[model samples]
Target chain A: MSNTFLIILFVLIGGGLFLSFLRLILGRKATDRAVALDTTTLITTGFLVLVAFLQGRSMLLDVALVYSVLSFLGVLAIARYLDGGLR
Target chain B: MSFMNILAHVVTGLGALVLFASGLGVFRMPDVFNKMHAGTKATTLGSVLFLFGLGLFEPSWLPKLFLIILFIVLTNPVSSHALARAAHNEPSEKPDNLIIDDLEESKGGDQ
Candidate 1:
């Protein structure tokens, strides 16, 4: 039963990722693309958590946690650059 | 047979739906600011729901999931706000009917 639930969660995360890719392809503005990328990162974090559960590995969550922090900082840096405030 | 399991599934399903809608909004919104709003708010909440559901399903992962949720709530809005401010600063061909120029006024001089 847990395996079945995990499978369903995988499908959901996969589908969300595909949709985020579509957004990345269709976005015309720089900010739009940035937002899409941010969403993609968030979805990836969720995906990692699901994988951790499937593998029964507690250590994977550590990686996901680090990724979440790094991605957030990345987005902030990009935003600052785009605003011409990076100096 | 377990109510918690049923609730977890429901929450996960809802989170997926939220994420899907956020993606659509990112593609369909008319302006960068609107798209950022949609993507940041919806996807952050969706991810939180997803992680919470996973924690419910796997009790052993409760601590990690809660931490993920906390980080998301802390960072999502800050990043989005920064993105929106950045977009506002960059020059763009305005839409035909845009009437307000608050940012322009704040700039104190026309570029």
Candidate 2:
């Protein structure tokens, strides 16, 4: 990827992350915050992958992959807890 | 410079834009269920397209990107559903605009 393209991608995802954070804090309910967190994690994974391209490193892809999996697990746990299913 | 490079740039740019839209949806939507819909559907697509474009730029990294994309696609909707269901079951905090709740109708005993 070109340097300019990388910059644009960074700005776009950064804006996305910022908005997601806004939603997280402004959320009225725990479920709303959870959904915002899920969105944030998803955007973060995409950002990480874009950074991998910028840095030209395959190792970063592994980090993104693992991070995505971990976040999904966390979302699941939060969902179960919210529903009173975990108890 | 080349056709392939331009393809990567356009695709990646558009993908990131979609992610931004998803965030906007989460922020501007009226209720939690609507926020879940926007956040999950659009972000799932944005991540897939963003990674696909990235893979086009660097073919060697495509495999790992594919893995991450698949994981996002499979998990996103499921997690959204779980969250929505959890929210719906909260009798005190029902969404104000929830229309025609069939789940509470068909299976009302549990809730």
Candidate 3:
């Protein structure tokens, strides 16, 4: 039962990643791409957590945390830059 | 097989579904702001739910999972707000059906 559940979870997340990637590629504007990128980062973070859960390893949790923090910073920087910065 | 196992599976499955919804919304929404609305809020909730479910699966990993959730809660809004402001500043990304122009008027006085 647990194995079936994990497979379903992976399929769902992969679909999300694929759709967001589609958006990233087809987005017309810079902001559209940025929004897609943000969604992808968030999904990736969750994926990392799920992987860690499956592996029963604590270290992967730290990796996921760091990945999220860095992605947050990246998205913030992109948003501020696009906002035109202290105009 | 166990009660906790079943609960974890259900919660995680739901979280995955919510994440899928967020992606769909981002793909289908008409404009940048609409996409941000779905991407930001849904992604935050979905991630939190997934992390909580994982924590349930392994009791020992609870603290760090909570830490991840805390970071997500704090940063998701800030990033989304910044993105919204950016989208507003760029007239090209503005939604077509937006009836109110309050932000346009406020922008001059506020910033």
Task: Give me the candidate number with maximum lDDT.
Answer: 3
What are the fnat scores of the candidates, in the order listed? 0.68, 0.83, 0.84
TM-score of chain A of each: 0.88, 0.90, 0.90
Docking class of 1: medium
Tens-digit lDDT track for model 2 on B1-111?
889888987888889999999988888888888888889889988998889998888988878788888888988888898888888878754687766778887777765
Model 2 bad stretches (over 4 Å): B109-111
Which pairs in model 3 have colliding backbones?
none
- After superposition, candidate 3 runs with Cα above 4 Å error: B108-111
Q: What do the candidate models score in CA lDDT, each in turn?
A: 0.81, 0.87, 0.89
Candidate 3: CAPRI quality band: high
> Least lDDT summed over 10 consecutive residues: which range in candidate 3 chain A?
A1-10
How displaced is residue B32 in candidate 1, in Å? 0.9
lDDT of 2 by residue, A4-75 (tens): 866777788999899999989988888889999999999999988877877788888899989998998999
lDDT of 2 at B45: 88
Ten-residue stretch with the least lDDT total in model 2 chain B: B91-100
Chain B TM-scores of the candidates: 0.87, 0.91, 0.90
Better model by lDDT, 1 or 3?
A: 3
